[model samples]
Every structure is written in structure tokens, then in C-alpha cells.
Target: MMGESNRTTEIPCEFYSDKYPDPSNHPITIVLFTLLYTFVFLISFAGNMGVIYATIRHRSLQTVQNIFIVNLAISGVILACLSIPLTPVTHIAKQWFFGSLLCRVVGGTQAIGTFIGTFSLCAIAVDRYFRLVIAPGRPLRKVNAMRITMIMWAVSIVVTLPYVYHMNLMKYSPKHGLCGWFCTEKWPSPFSKRAYTIFVLVIQFLIPFSIMTVCYHAIFSFLRKRAKTRLTSIAQQANLLYVLAATAGRETQQHKEQMTHLLDQKKRVVAQKRRVTLILVSMVFIFGITSLPHNFVSTLMEFTDSRDLLTFYKTDYTYIVSLLTHLVGNEPDTTVAPFASLQPLHSFVNRYHSAVIPCANFETVFIWYINEYSGQFSSLAMLSCVTNPLLYAFLNPEFRELVLNGLAGVSWANNFVSKSWHPTQTTVL
Candidate 1:
């Protein structure tokens, strides 16, 4: 729906006509993208649900870091659910099929989706650094996580206000056409599209990205120092223990066994920590990859004149808008890619049950699940669906464990398929 003042026939409608064009759009491109879209949607759906499954089933995962992650996953799922089912149409018609209400829904969703996807990572970075540097002993409590999540949602809604309220559907020449679904601003002003675009890219993207870099750098440094110190302490203790045991004259096999058990346990903890760290680093790289293009194009778009901006928006070159439109908004796929890659974590989650998940808090999880399952949006929705749970399930270890346990409790089908089979004997050995 076109919002605000509708000047009839003022703008050329050559590109779009009074009558619907016969299906001349390339089927091959649509078919290929449809496949890509379906593939991405399915991944995102499973990923976000997995995140929800993990978080709710395990109390240990209910920390502020993970709650925030669930929030991101919820947003991604919402975006995906709203967007994916409509993919074929978007591929075929190059137009919005749903009514004005859905158009605004799509528009508002795209805005919220991107904000949460990018903003959640921003929040995670801040929270992570806060924990690492400020208070390693104290986790961000659940109450505080709720507070932060509420604020984030509030702000996201506020940011999306322009689209949610300002949008209107236009009935052009006896033909009803839904225009401007993907973060498209209908009414033009002094800044027109530029102001909103700048707000989205600079404030939402550039600002957060800057913060993330600093936080990660600090976290990385802290982890390095901590690891070295731990190694040193272990080495010193080993030497001392060896010397003391020798002095005792007779070494008990039980003592040796106990010491071996302790070392093995310590090794597991270190490995677990390393796995989480790997997730964080992977997120950093992907975040940069997915977001940098949009930000770069945004920066260029902001500086250049209308013609250039329109060209950039319309051309779909590099499929930048489509990438943002479909990829980042969906946070599940973002995390799921990593989850799928990390077989150990995925295998564990596969066994977990959804029923054991805290029913009280599953609205958000349901929100995520529905979004991914209903995938009906253009590529924009896909982008918003993919990013969140990646950070949750991978970057944060406890959340990963929670997701594992939750899956074990519910989703009987998934539980069996993921966990029924034994790992390869080689790995067990």
C-alpha cells in the first residue's frame, strides 16, 4: 500500500501497469532463488526452534545473556514466519499478494527484524564484555535480562513505528497493487528515504558494529590472558604434585586415578569454553560479512544523490538489499549454520525434548517457531530470520546446553533422530 498523499498518474507507471503483466518473469531465476529461499528458510526454522528448545529446557541457560539471545531468535522467527511462505509469489509476480494490512505487516516486520538481528548482537557484545571485564562471578540475572529485552523490544517497535503506522495501500486504476514491502518508506521528506536509511544503517548498524568490534577485541584479549594463567597454574601444580607424590614413598593407584579424573574434567571444561569461543569468533566474521555490504551500500547511498540511491535499491546488484531482506533478519539460520557445523552440539540438541521447555516462557519460543515454519516473506524476511540464535546457541555455552536439554524433553521425533544413533566408534575411543 502506498502511504500519505497519492498523486494519481503523476509518476510514470511504465514499469508497473494498470493490468497485471502476464507471467513473463524468468522462471529459472525464480526457481533457483525459490530453492535458495526454501533451503535458507528450512535451516532458519530448525535453527531458531532449536535455540528455543535449548533455552527453555535447561534452567542453567536462563541467564541474561541467553534470554537476550532468545529475544533475537524470537525476532528472527517472526520475520521468517511472516515472510517465507510468500516466496514463490515474490519470485513469480514481483509484487505483494497480501492486502494492505499484510503489506504493513511485512514492512514493519522487515524493520523490526533487522533492528533485532543487528541490535541483539550489539547487546550480546556489551553483555559479554560486561561479564568478562566487570563481573566474571556475577551473570546478568534473569530479571535484568527481562528488563533489557523489554527495552530492546520497545525500542525496536519505536523504530518501526514509521512503517507500522505511516504505511497505506494504494488501489491504482481499478487495479490494486501493494508496493513498498521491504523496508520501503512511502512518504518522502527533506531526508526522505535517506534519513530513515541513515537511521537504519548508521545508528543501527555502524554504531553497533563499532561497539561489537571493541567488545570482541577486549573479550579475546581477556580470554587469552586467562587461558595462559590457567595453563601456568596447572603446570606448577603438576610439578608440585609429582614431587610430593615421590616424597610419599608409595604412590597409591587410587590417587593417580583421582588425579587423572581431575585433569580430564579440567580438559573438558577448557574444551567447552573453546567451543563457545569458536562460536563467538564465527559470529563476528558472519556478522561482518552479512552486515558490512548493507552498511557500505547504505553509506554510499546516503552520500550520493537520489538517482544513485534508486539505482542501488532497484538494481539488486550483489543482491545487497535482498541479502539483508532475506538473510540477517532471520537469526535462526545464522546460528543453525554453525550448529549444523558443530556436530557435537547438534547431536546433543537432536536428543533434547521440547515439552520439558518452560511452558511459562515459551511464547517467545513459539513466536520464533511459527515465524520459521511459516516462512512466506521476500528475501528481506529471510535476512532478519537468520542471525540471533547463532550467537545464543554457539557464542554462549550455557544456552547451548539448555537447548540440548530442552530438545531431549520435547520434540520426540527430533529427540530420537538426533540422539538415537551412537557417535562413530572412533570418536568415542
Candidate 2:
């Protein structure tokens, strides 16, 4: 039903006819997907948990930016725990086994996490811009950061309510007479569905992307301008010192030492500014790359008819050829009967067996292939959860120290962390 139709009316489970078996059902595919999902879960969960634990355990790590990072880590943990585990199962089974209550809860939780993460990123960008550009050296207060975090959660929850309400568990009987259930959105009308889709696209992607872009651009420009001015002033001072030394006929050791110190200081300042800019830019770029694909697919699905989508994919020679080759080579027996071992349903099977035969056609296979891969692409958005923690660990040295110190109770980890510890340098940017 998910990939087959976009209409509000109930569709029969024949929409998922076994004739067009899901590609994800292949044994190798299932195993690979399982491993991938497991890795994502472990990394995202453990990494984000570490961030949260460090922030809570160490007052020194509880800065304004780290507050937003903690919020993001919380969202990542939610996604890893609630969403990633169910993704592969749903794709392979092409059904929702977790009933109606879970359907609503999981759907709502996903939306809330997405909203909170997006908002937190924007908040971080704004905080950085204000600290660096608007009021240099004055960081946001922890109390205000806490208030902003609360507001973000509240707004995210409110915006996700309608989406949760529309998450329906639809049950229908396939031609094989077996009842199947799937969780999907059941909007009152097509207009409402499109409206909500557009609303989410705007709130989740457009506004936040624009905000990050503008804020980061302004911050970069400000830093570049300030750095250029400082460098020019330093160069002038060096020239004046050189003239003085030449006129005096001898350069004093103190003057040479002072010149060298100023140059070193300028280099450090420039390097620090560049590092900060690069980290923020990388964060913004990764967010866009991971978010755009899922949003684009959603837009296409909502705006175009299923038949149109099928037709579009049908025209793709590569997908059709590859799908055919894979099915033909891997699945030699395409005519395998549906639920062949269920002897109790023999009469029912005989009655409607012919109904299931039509689905073996080319169009059904193409549709299944398209939907399977689209769902796979949509899952890529979850990579943001993985990437966020990794970025923090690698780019933010102070946070990394906090995480390592938190793990210092373990023998091997403590040895490694102690060897790497350098508290005097403060490489936070």
C-alpha cells in the first residue's frame, strides 16, 4: 500500500502481491542490511550516550553549544533506539507487525526527534553567530540555553501531533487470504496530505537550512574580515619595528623575540579561526547532504501519482535490466506458489489462487523494486545521527576530552585517555 497508492481510500493487500517479491528479502541483502543497521545503532546510541553522560557528569563540559549538542544527542539516541531497529524488518516483511499503538508512537517519536534535531542545529548556529559576531567573547548563558531547549521540545511535540494522528494501521487480506497489516498515513484528503507534506518540508528543511546558511555565512565573513584587519595591523607593526632596528644600526634580542612572538600569535589566531569555520561549515554541509534525499523522495511521492512514478521508473533501462537479471539469476523459480504449506487454507487458496497470478507481471516487479530502493534512500537520513556524534568527537577536542575522561574508570580506556590528555591547550574551536 505504501508504494502502490497515494489515495485516501483503503487498498487491498494484493497491492503487496508476492509475485513482485521485495529485493530486500534476498538472504544476502537481509544479512547486509541487518549488519549495517546494527552498526548504525551501536555507533549512534553509544556515541550519543557518551556525549550526554559527559555533559551531565562534568560541569566544565556544560557550555551553551554543548547544551544544544546534548539535545541533538538525545534525539539521535531516540532515533537509534526506536527507529533504526524496525527499518530493515519493515522493508523485508513489507508489513507492520507492531500494532496500532506502536504505529502512532513510533511515527510521532520519529517526527519529534527530527524536529528537535533540526531546531537544535539552528539554535547552535545562532548561538555561535551571536557569540562570535554579535557579542564577541560573550557566550550564551546556561539558563537561557535550557529555556531554548525547552521551547524546541515543546514546538516539536506540537508540530508532530497531526502527523501522529494520521498514522493509521491498515489491515487487509491479500489474494492468498492471509490478513496483513501496514502502518501508513491516512489523511482525510489528498489536499490535506499535500499540505502537511509541504508544511513539514518547510519546517524541517527549508527554514533551518536557510537559517544555518545565513548565520554561518555571516560568521565566516566576520571572522575573515577581523583576521585580515588584525594581520594588516601586525604587518604594519613589524615594518615599523624593522625601520627602527635599521635606523638604530642594531636589532635588539628583545625586539627580534617580540617580532617572532607576534608572528606566531597571528598564525595561531588564524589557524583557530579557520578550524572553527571549517567545523561549522562541515556540519551544515553534512546536514544538507543527508537530509535532502529523503525530503526529495517524499516530495516526489506526495506530488506525483503512483502510476506516474511506476511509469517513470519503468523507463529507466538500467533499473529494469538489473532487476530482471537479479531476479532471473537468483530466483530461478518465479512461479513459487503463495503460502504453499498452509494446508488449512487449501479451499480458500484454490478459490482465489488465480487472483495472485497477475502480479507476476513486469509492472509489479518494477513497482516493488522502486519502492524498495526508495525506502532505502529514505533511511539514509538516519545517517545524520551517526555523523553528528562523529563530528563532535573529531572536531571538538574539549568534548572529546570530556568523553575520554568519563570512560577513564575502565583500565584500558583510562590508559589511552591519560596518554592523550593535555588539559592546558583548550583546543575547543
Candidate 3:
């Protein structure tokens, strides 16, 4: 299961071979995190499902923007259905209970889903900006939109193939006489690990965020100028109408109806502007908050050497291995740590540090980081999953109506919820 190579690394084995250790040793921590994970998984699954259903059931929601929303929903659904459930299971089991094949498939699927989700957000922002600013009055064709989505999935799968390759089912024997399968990466070239991680961080997170920032800013500026110009024109028309009414000695019914219509149109335009502003603001804010911390930690771990963090942890894994061997009544090797049991994990870490520019074994560091900040990841997953649907319901009256209609269409639920609630549709300009 340890890939096709025999070169062992002891540090990774030490972390993986032991039986489920209660690292936190707090019952409350376990209970709280378990509840959090369960809540996130359930809500994410339901919310994303609702988004997909609404998009498919309602023709009004089949616009280019909503198409991207559907794509985002699909990615969120994959993660919520397949990946989020594993968080609590891994926390409780403390070992890779699933075999090697599942190990690669699950890891690769999560990577694919996450990357797709981020890219979908970027695509949506770009499409919106393109329609409003670059090519006003011309909507993107449905065929072109479908092609873009297909290309996105294709690129994502290609990017994720490496994760499937590097991931393996780890097995090892330790001084305590423990042995078991643990899921981890066994890099063919340790240097590739550093390059792969940094590549993912930049391509998936940093570049997307930058794109969103620029697109959103340009959208905001254009809307502001346009709104101001329209307002000025309306005010001038009002002054002219007043002067004409004074000259004629009375305001005609036709003039009054015209004024009322203009006022209503102005109000609708203002509301539409506010809704668009909220949509982009919430998207940018939620994505930045949920994703930045995890990527920052991952990037920091990638660039910094193990030696830097080793001093902070105050425990040389090599020294700890020697200590463990002496406790088990074995003569310690002067050149290597005496625990042949620890070979696989140590070899993997050492090869990376020596072969590449000095960098930490991210797998071990990330696991420790995950244990320390378990709640953060859970919160991120839950918040990200729920954001798109919640924003649609909050900002788009049409989508909200569609969701209500779909719910009311359910036979058992129809009695309580009315299916006739409809509002005037606001067309995006």
C-alpha cells in the first residue's frame, strides 16, 4: 500500500502508526467538533441541493449568471456529500480505516471539488463584468456558457491527477508494536510536493481572489457613474414639467401619470443597483474570510523549513525516536534513529528537506495543524457551502420565489405553504 517504493520515512510512520490518540484529551472538544461537523454536512447538503433544484426547475433562473451558480452548487454538493462527512470520521478513527484506493479517490475528489468551486466564483465575476462593462446589451450565448463549464471541469481534473498519484495507503510498525494503514502522500519526488502545494495555493486561491477584486471594483464604479447620470436626467425632467404646468395654469392628468411612472422607474433602478452591490460584496467577503486562513497557513508551512518550526515545537523527531528505542530496550544507532519502525516517515521527511530546498513534511505539519484548528476548517466548509444559496434567497426575489414554489409543489408540504406568492420581476440592466 506504500506506493511502489521501499524508501521508508519514520516521521510520517510515527504520526500514523499509533492507535487513535486523544490528542486534545477533552471530551467537550470532541463533542463540540462532532456536532459542528454534523451540522455543517447536513446544512451544506440541503442548501446546495436547493440551489440546484431551483436552477433546474425555473426557466427564469437559466441566465448566464445562474448557470455559474449551478456549477458552484454542483461543486459544493460534491464536497458536502463526499468530503465533509469524512472530517468527523477521521477525527474519531485517528487512522485511515478506508483502504488505499479510497484514499486516492477521496483526496483527489476533494481537491477537484474545492478547485472547481473557487474557479466558478471567478468565472461568475468575470462573466458579470464582461456583460455589464465590456459588451453591454449582448448576453453570452447558452452554448458558449456550456462550453466554458466543460472546459473548467476538464482543467480541474487534469490539475487534480497528481493528488491521486501521490496519495497512498501508509502502513508501518512502531516500537510500541503498532501497525495499521494510514492515508498520506508518498511523493515520487519530494520536491514536487512543494511545487504542487504552492501551485494550488496560487492558482486556486490567490489568482481567483485577485480576479474577483478587480472585476467587482470595476462593476461598482460603472454602476455608480451610471446611477448618478440617470438621477440627474430625472431631476431635469421634473423641473421642466413643473415649468410647463405653471405656464398652462394647471397640471394635466397625462402629465401626472407620466411623472408617477418616472418616479417608479427611478425607485426600481435604485433597488436593482443595491441588490447587485450586495451580491458582489457578500461573495467577495465570504470567500476571502473562509479561504484565506487555511491557504495562508499552508503557504507558510511550504516556504518555511522544518528546522524553523522544530525549535518552536522543542522536540526533534529524531531525538524522540532514539528515546523511544531506549525505552523499548534497543541499542540506539549513532547515525540514524534506532527505530527501524520509524524508517518510512523519517526517510520521506529527510528526502524532502535534503533533495528540495529545505521545507517541512507538510503532511505531518498539516495534520497537527488540522488537529489544533479543527473547528476552523469545519466552519469554513459550512459557511462556504451555504453562502451561494443564502445570498440568492436574500438578494434575488425571483430565486426566492422559485424556491418557495418548488417547496410548495411537494405534496405533503403544499397545505401549509402557498404556491401563489409572486413578486414583480426585476430585470437586470
Candidate 4:
């Protein structure tokens, strides 16, 4: 198998591409990129940690929605610390410096974090849809919430196992010179890689996105119907003739108070529903928008012809020679000078690299784009991580109150907000 798989000995073509920034030659590019990624990591870490701490410390914020929020925060924290931070290093470095083991670990952790986050958002959407539309007045139990959260994490891990299984750490050969360490999949076949790409794109993203869309639409429809019904019922009740003498003294006073309480309760429920819906919708929107391009590009790449996409360089003769002599079982043409810059090396690598290993499909324009913009997209996605805590704080008054009250103990500055505060039950807008 090792002899059969020797085709990876081809010189690394990526380093020769003008698309990637040469940090050695352009040091400022590395600095700017590093600063950006570092900012994302710090902000994401702090925001997610704040959310987890706030959710756990506040009794009023322990609803099922908050549970999902906390779980997603955990995922975000992992992304910030484990997965996301590594992106800067990859972007600046000449090649994948990490060994095969760390490669799998990092790649797998990233996949896990992404899947869990995406699914957690979907779960929140589903929960809201059910609560407001399907099972109004029935609260989700803590036990059941815990069960669902566990299931989400479990499924995410299982679904992303391919990232770990196929990831290989490749070292640059002497002939390849300074290509450095790179991690890529060594899939057994091109079809397998394409299948997996499509599978992940569809299952993890497209399906969840569709589900959220449908759930939100249904929830909105239900809310609109209820609003219209309530307005109509109020108009009808107002039109009904009622004699003032019918319910004279004591009973009338008690009835008026009872009606007031009921109206206030209904108002509170409606406000809470609206606020919760808004928060979830915002989350779904941000996630869907930021993640859509990456998934679409990846899925689209599966259909692209890698032969036409890769750029060949003068240094790729080792790969071309090995391909023609070993795999093609053809005599080397003495007419062509060795190591001469040629275009056919690109074709040779694309044609037979898959036969040698599983991950040849990664050599495409899509992968090139991903490598180039990885930091940018990662930063974009992590922007959502920080925004989530802020969203909850703004949307849920109870959460905002808790955060403020927690801030109230520090100094005169803290006391200022504390003085202005009055405790109130959770009321949604």
C-alpha cells in the first residue's frame, strides 16, 4: 500500500501559487492577519464564557432556551480556544506544520464545534416553534432539555468523524524542498471525498437551514392568526350589550380585578413569545448568512474539474516523472528535460493522485479559496459567537437584569445602575 501510495511525493504546488501571501517576503500581511484572528479569538472566548457563567449563575435564566444557548457557548469557547485560534497559524505558515495526530485532533475539534453550534441553533428554533405554535402553555422540562442537548453533541461527534479519520499529516520531501508540513485527507477514492463533501453540506447545513425556515414561518403564521383572533374577539365582546345593573356592587369589583390580572398575564406571555422569537430568528439569520458561502463553495467544488483548477509550477517535475514512470508504466521521454517548467504536471497530479490516496479532490479552486479566506470566514463566524451573548442580554430583560445586578457590587459606578433598577418579572416586548 505504501509503494502504491507513493504518488504524494509530488512537489507541493500550493507554495508556488501567487494567491497565498508569502509571510517571509511580506511580513506585514502576517501581522495584520494575526491581529485579526487574535481579536476574534479573544472576543469569542470572553463573550461565550460570559454567557455560560451568566446562564449558570442566574436562576431566572435557566429556561430551556438558555440551556441551548449555554451549550452553544461551550462550543464557541472550544472554537475560540482550540479550533479558531489555529487558523491564523495556518494562514501565515508555508505549510501545515502540525503533525498528523494534531492535525486530526484540531480538524476534528473544529468540525465538532461547528456541527454542535449549528445544530444547537436549530434546536433552539425547533424548541421555540413547538412552544409557541404546537404546544402552547406546556413548558419544556429541564430533564428533557438535558437529554436533547446530549443528543445534539453526540450526533455532531458521530457525523464529523470523517474529518478525523481521513486527515493525514504530510511532510515535505527533500525534492519538494520547503513545502513544510501539511494536513490533508488521504481518502481511498475521489468519489468518497465528493460524497462526503455533499453529505456534510446537505445534512449539516442545508437541512438545518430548511428546518429553521419552515419552523419560523409556521410560528409566525400561528402568531399572526392568534393576534387576529384576539382582536376580533375583543371587538365582538365590546359590541355585546351588557347592562350595568346586571352585576351591581361587590361582584363587579372582583370581576374587574380578575379581568385586569388575566389581561396582564396574557400581555406578558405575548411579549415573552415575541422577544424569544426575535432572538432565535436573529441567531438563525446570522448563522445562515455567515456559513452559507463556505458550504456552498465546498459543495460546488465536488462537481468542479480539479484538472483545470490547479496551477502547476516549474518545481513539479518530480511528481510528473514519478507519475509517468510508476503509475502510467510508460517510458520517460528523453526528449523533455527534467525539472523543466511544464503544464502537464498539473494534469498528471489531478488524474492519478486520487488513485494513490483518497483526498485528491481537495486540490481544487474551492480548496484554494478556503485556504486563502479561511481566516476571514472563521472570523466572520466567530463574530456570531460574541454577538450571541449581546443578543441575549438585549432581548431578555431578565438576563440583562442579572448581568447588571452582577455588575452592581463593584463600585459607585455599579451602584448607579443598581439604584435605577427595579425588579420585575420577565416580560417580553
Number of the top TM-score candidate: 2
The 0-to-1 C-alpha lDDT of every candidate, in the order given, reads 0.49, 0.60, 0.57, 0.53
Worst 10 residues of 4 by lDDT: 332-341
Error of 3 at 119 (Å): 1.9
Query: lDDT per residue, candidate 4, 85-203, as tens digits?
Result: 45434433434556666767766766677777778778877887788777878968889999999999899888777646766665433343334445555567777765765677677
- Count clashing residue pairs in model 4: 6
Model 3's alpha-carbon lDDT is 0.57
TM-scores for the candidates = 0.64, 0.76, 0.72, 0.68
**TM-score of model number 3:** 0.72
Across 1-429, the per-residue lDDT of candidate 1 in tens digits comes to 354346554454322212223222445655666677677778777788788767676666666777767777876676566556553444244334476666566656655765776677788888888887778787778787788778887888887776455454432222222222211123444344445545655666578878988887787777767766776776676676678788998677865875686586467547645754665576577676655643554344234323222124334222223323444433211101100001011011011111122113324223222211111111222453555555456434344434554556566634434442332211110
Clashing residue pairs in candidate 2 are none
Cα RMSD, model 4: 11.9
Q: Top model by lDDT, which number? A: 2
- Compared with the true structure, what per-residue lDDT tens digits does model 2 show for residues 298-387? 566444424333234433222222222212110010111121101110110011111122234445433423332222223345666777
lDDT of model 1 at position 203? 60
TM-score: which is higher, 1 or 4?
4
Per-candidate clash tally:
47, 0, 15, 6
